[model samples]
Target chain A: MRILEYIALMAVPAVVLFAGVVMLFGGKNYFESFIKGAKEGFATAVGLLPTLVALLAAISMLRASGAIEFISSVLKEPLSALGIPSEIIPLLLTRPFSGSASSALFSDLIGNIGPDSFASLCAAVIMGSSDTVVYIISIYFSSVNIKKTRYAFPLAFVVMLFCIFFSCFICRIWFK
Target chain B: MLGKIFGIICIVSVFFGIACGNTGQLGSAVIDGASSAVTLTLALLGMMCLWSGILNVLKEAGAIKKLTVLMTPILKFFFPDAYKSGVGSEEIAANVAANLLGVGNAATPLALSAMKKLQLQNPTPEIASRDMITLAVLNTSSVSLIPSTVITLLRSSGSENPFDIIIPIWITSFTCAAMALILCRALGSATRVRTIRSKDYKSLKTQARQ
Candidate 1:
């Protein structure tokens, strides 16, 4: 199983390289296009700089302001009643805003509480399954100048709720 | 300006708390956390730029286009309305494929391009059509196969197996996608019923006019 996993991991880069080669042959201007694309990609990366800073700063503020603690306290009773650990609440709440920040929190949980713990595993799973809905809305929609996202928020929230419930249930049933 | 304001506020807040000596350790922790956050933000921005560059190269090489074609049928089922225009299907498929691969940083441009094509087909942009809403719904709940960024974090955090949660994650993702689809369809049916009722009233009015 480990060998297969390694092979799968290796396959992605191989496929990408193969695709690149295929493109090189598909057109006379393949090299030019590739260079142009790379430039555009780099430009996009530079453009995302401010949003990334803002996200990190906001995360910092939230943590510094004791907002996370306050939130955890408020959610403690309800989440614990649902069989989730208090530790997982921060990940569940923050994962949809800043993926890196949530991951940092996840790392802290794993380091402090141990990765083998059910809470860590559940947090990891929830982070993977859920999309960063708020980030997506702020970035994608705003970039496209989309003023009204009629169904977007509702759909994202519903899916997130379902994933959280289902993930918690599965973790309890299988890992427990 | 906002960043500077936030930085100042954070510093001031820390000093105020420290001067009061209300909670020395907490004040220190807050300052330390904020400074670390600035560093991490800088690092994340750098990483995003690198990934965006790679994605752009891949896209220009036509890998994205080919991948979109390969995924079109599946994408069609997910976003049926995207194909209303001639080549809109390919653009939507490409955008979605990029998004699912956790390449949303790269997918942003493709999505914008597709949205432009879609807008051209629409007569009125004031109200979203059923198809447009469906596209938005699917995009919002787009299933992820590999949680790349999460796995990276787990690996850095010393997980024995960063990808250990893959199976559970996939299961949860599919469940969410399934539910999103069902809800969209139910909502769509109600809209259809309303449309039919309105169409009937319009026909009756036409008959009265005649």
Candidate 2:
């Protein structure tokens, strides 16, 4: 099983390299395209600066203001009553909009709690199945100048709730 | 500013609630939690800026375009409306790719760009067309495969098997994606029918002229 997992991991890179090689053989212009692609990728990285700053600042404020903890406590009972672990609340809450922040929180969780624990598993699943709703909706809709997105926010919240609940439910069945 | 105001109100409310409830520990917990959150959030912002900047560079260099080409077929199936306008398709693909890679920080700008392009193609700004809504749904319910940050957190927390959650993660993500897709389709069809009916009513007078 471990070997299979290793193979799976290796496969992604192997395929990427193979494609790169194939492109190289396709024509001399392949190099130009590759360079151009890389350059564009770099530009995309730069273009994300302001949003990152805002997200970071917001996250900081939320944390500093005790808003996250407050929300966490508010959510604790319902989540725990549902058989969801308390430790995962932070990761689950943050995962949707700020990937990096969520990852950091995930790391902190794993560090504070044992990784093989139920809390860790639940956090991982929640992160995988959900997205950052507010960030995506605000940025996407605002960019397009769409003033009304009646369905987007509600749908995002529903999806996140479903993901958390479903992941917890399934994990209980599979792991236990 | 609004967020700050809301935060303060929340804090004050919590403090009073704790005092009234005679939960002494609650106050301390809130303080500690808030301070830690602020610190962590600051760190996260720095990381986001750095990462986003790099992603921006990638976009400028055309890597995003290359990625769009790579993911074109899937995007076409998922976002047929976007494909009608070359720009929409490209931007949508880029945004989706960024999300998939666990780069929400990078995905925001791309999503914005895609929305802009999508808006141009869709003149009726009042209503979100079928394709637009579908894309919105998919974007909102992005399926994350690795949950890299979560795994790292688990490992840090002294978990013996951080990646053990992979199977469960995959199961949940696939399920959510399937369900979201179905719901979006159903809602889209219903909305389309309503829009058509409205159009028919508006053209009722013209039908007599014809």
Candidate 3:
């Protein structure tokens, strides 16, 4: 953990320094290149705005309507039977769909249970290891204007489930 | 598939909430969701531009090329089709590099760029190719060496050992990424086989007619 923390703290600075030194010796016009890329980024963000609005609204609706909570409650028993802590089920359900919602659920979990508990640890690990699959898939695909995401959706969902279960399992052993 | 799911979820949520007499919350949720999306995008926009600028500088300096060279062996295993095609490999490498470096903001822009490049090589423009799916799955599985956000949240919440879960996260992230890659490869190959068989069947029928 000490070494990991050190690496995390230093990674950004190290990479930036390395890039700067390389650019200096490489004789590239750094500012021009940066501006060009920044323009591309601006386009990407603007292009994604519509999709973000739609996706986030739907996810929030699911949450606001109590659907996510309802779904999590129904799955709580079976998930707990499979060794998932019932307390973490809400985060698990929400994490794959929306980042903000999951983070909210995560803090709620940590706040309710305290940070050092097994469930909170699991939540942290889960949140760290996985991502908002639907969001990533939609944004990435839509950014490229690819409407037919054939198998990406199903494959991503499958992996999301795997990550959730695996994160809990690893946390159980590692934190224990 | 995703659009359908989103539509269904939205419709069901609206109806369910109204039926359950939570119409006020549902209305607010829709407004909040859209508003938050705007806020999130605004926040992400600057970071995306900043990181994109830096990454482009790195690319111009050939730093990313060197990193891609170093990553080839591992990337080859994960992105076989992209490597073989010799297209979008650079963006893929850059995207993966950003992801490994734990720069989420940079990763998204790089990933979107990579997806665009991959689309160039896509035979079917409307449909995603296998490599595109692989990239998305890879991102979804999240191979971040340091999950800085989670750590920040944990630290802010006053955890005694905030970094304690790093090892577990590293393990789980790697496992999930590997599993996702393998699953995509397996599924991709299965679909390929079916497509090939269909092509053969069509060719056979044409030969018979001739």
Best by lDDT: 3
lDDT of each: 0.61, 0.61, 0.76
For B137-164, candidate 3 gives per-residue lDDT tens digits of 8999888765655765676667877767
Clashing pairs in 1: none
TM-score of chain B alone in model 2:
0.70
| lDDT, candidate 2, A41-79, per-residue tens | 445444544434344443433444454567678888988
Chain B TM-score (model 1 vs. true structure)? 0.67
lDDT of 3 by residue, A1-176 (tens): 66866765575567567667765776756778878877887787677778667766776777678666666688878988776777787677567777666665575567558889988998898898888998889988988888888789988888888778888888877766
In the range B1-210, model 2's lDDT, one tens digit per residue, is 334433554555555455455344454544554455444444334334433333344334455567767878866765666675665776677777776555555676666666667777774675566666667777777665445544444544456655566667767887887777677666665666677567567678679889
Best candidate, DockQ: 3
Candidate 3 ranges with C-alpha deviation above 4 Å: A1-74, A145-147, B1-66, B196-210
**Residue pairs with backbone atoms closer than 3 Å in model 3 (clashes):** none
Which structure among the candidates has the greatest TM-score?
Answer: 1
- lDDT for model 3, please: 0.76
Per-residue error at B110 for model 1, in Å? 1.9
Please give, for residues A144-164, the per-residue lDDT of candidate 1 as tens digits: 455665566777787787788
**In model 3 chain B, which range of ten residues has the least summed lDDT?**
B192-201
- Which regions of candidate 2 are displaced past 4 Å? A1-4, A7-83, A86-113, B1-13, B20-67, B85-87, B103-105, B196-210
Model 2: per-residue Cα lDDT at residue B172: 83
lDDT of 1 by residue, B171-194 (tens): 777777778767776675566456
